[model samples]
Target: KFAAELGRGDKVRFAGSTADLKISEVLSDAHAIADDDPDLETLPSSEHALPSEPATFDVMKRVDQKVVYEKVLDELASGGTLGIFPEGGSHDRTDLLPLKVGVALIAYSALEKDGLAVPIVPVGLNYMRGHRFRGRAIVEFGAPTYVNPDTLDSYKRGGADRRKACNDLLEEIEDAMRSVIVSVPDYEALQLVHTARRLFQKSPNVDARDKQDMSRRFAEAYKQLVARAGTDPPQKWLDLQERLLAYRRELSDLGIRDNQVPGLDRERRHAEAGNYDGDDVLGGGRLLYHIVHLVWVLCLAAIPALFLNIPVGILARVYSDRRRRKALAASKVKIHGRDVVLSE
Candidate 1:
């Protein structure tokens, strides 16, 4: 469910070699075992789930300091943009984790080498529902941070001086990354904010032109709400959240979605125009037409679903599971649909 944005460039250069890019190059974390004395079959696991489909591998040769610095130096020297995700690995979390220091070190070292004008761009991957199939995602790119030659000089000083310079640079990157992400205080807030955004878009003030714009607006709104609430959210906000969650829960129990509700403004317009009937309203000739249309569609869909999708899905799970002793665990946020199929 992760999304990322890169600045326009002449060519895209992957950070790793061709060998490390395969789907089964590395094993997942789900297969780790603990060795207890003479016994080596202990299979207790941790909470973290790595990515399932994509094989995880450490492109150690590319990441090595000498190699990485030389490679990046050469790229920049030839007017190339080197993209890197400083998080090292992906996991399911609302907030951004501590960035790898390698990015800062690279920029600093590059600046020192030949005063290369390197810019560290912080991009945020905002997923509406990460784990769900067809879930929406938005990529927000923050301002480009240019390397400070003086900062590199401090790094050259060695010891605490070097550490402080690097830390400061890392902090800057973190702040930039945070600016674009919808980082709520907790899971409850995350749900509340999402629910609110879906409902509140009915208001005239909120524009629905683009998902990315909506994300930015939501981030701004959440920031303001946090500011107003201080240590604790207002009781009114809490009450509203409770109501929204309750409504959502009731819909879930009935096997319906919020968008399926008849009262939705978009649904109302369609109903009034007589062009379509909301899924919530099951009466009228339109409903019968829809039912018939759906049946035929499903009948046609079954062919591909059975022969193509089912076999491929089964083969994928079986092959990945057999080749590795571990399950690849990855965390994803989901929104909108119930069509989620977890990656094994």
Candidate 2:
């Protein structure tokens, strides 16, 4: 439907579990070892039990996957575009899940089939609380990567070199995806990053998309810190989280938001520009500002929230919450599956 609207309907062919044939889904999430590289070695897989797929997925896995594989190859062979999730499943984690190796195999197979390089473009669908109403998302696109000619040549050698080629290509794909994603240790860390972003913001007008770069950096740094600290994080990090959470909670309790905090703009300028001449604390001016701010918020945010809740907001939330829980339960990798529900 979207393809037709986008005017690429003729050029795109979508694959699916049962409605269509996706080689990866048909293989029961198996790594595509059976594809032509006779030397491809089977690696240990699924350290944790994977989520249960729909009944159709189980039934589809029993069918020969070669036909679907051929269809994918034929699509590529004929210069058609192919879009795949690469993970072969939906996930809600802050970090990138382990990519299913099927995508790499498909690329390799397509290259070997016709001696043509297949381009893999990594796309990141980053969202801010995607399950919520009016949640925001950013579609970030990375540079297109192609299977290395050397890797293809090595794959043709049909030995351990073949396995190395496959592994190398898979690693490359993962790296490309990682380059465009904002990955943190967990949801708690993500929220902390958001709070920090809000406090450090130069202007209250900054939206989620505008802060994505800062958020990405914070996520990367925090993850690295967590990795270095091991089981227990540094006390300073914990203290910072505690303080930030407390500040945010206080803002929530008052009818004031982070943006509306008294002297927030003044402090932001002082901190960034190193100007300390002006007083950070406002007395009566602050009270007057907040009084006006509170009324404005009620007229804008609160009223709409109440109106939306009455019709679709609460009901959609209830259904989405239940679906999120179910998705989280069945999946090995998904942390919350909130994004999955929104996408669904």
The best candidate in terms of TM-score = 2
Score each candidate by Cα lDDT.
0.60, 0.68
Which candidate leads in lDDT? 2
Instruction: Provide the global lDDT of candidate 1 against the true structure.
Output: 0.60
The estimated TM-scores of all candidates read: 0.62, 0.65
How does residue 76 of candidate 1 score in lDDT? 82
lDDT of 1 by residue, 1-344 (tens): 11122111111112221111212222233332211211111111221223356543442222236776788888887789888988765545565544667788878877888778688887777775665556776777878887676677789998678877887887788778876677764556677677666666664444333444565467668768878898899898778768988987987898976556655767678768887545545566678899999999999979867887888878875655543333222222212112223444
Q: What is the lDDT for 38 in model 2?
A: 26
Candidate 2 wrong stretches, greater than 4 Å: 1-63, 203-210, 262-318
TM-score of 2: 0.65
* Span of 10 residues, lowest total lDDT, candidate 2: 9-18
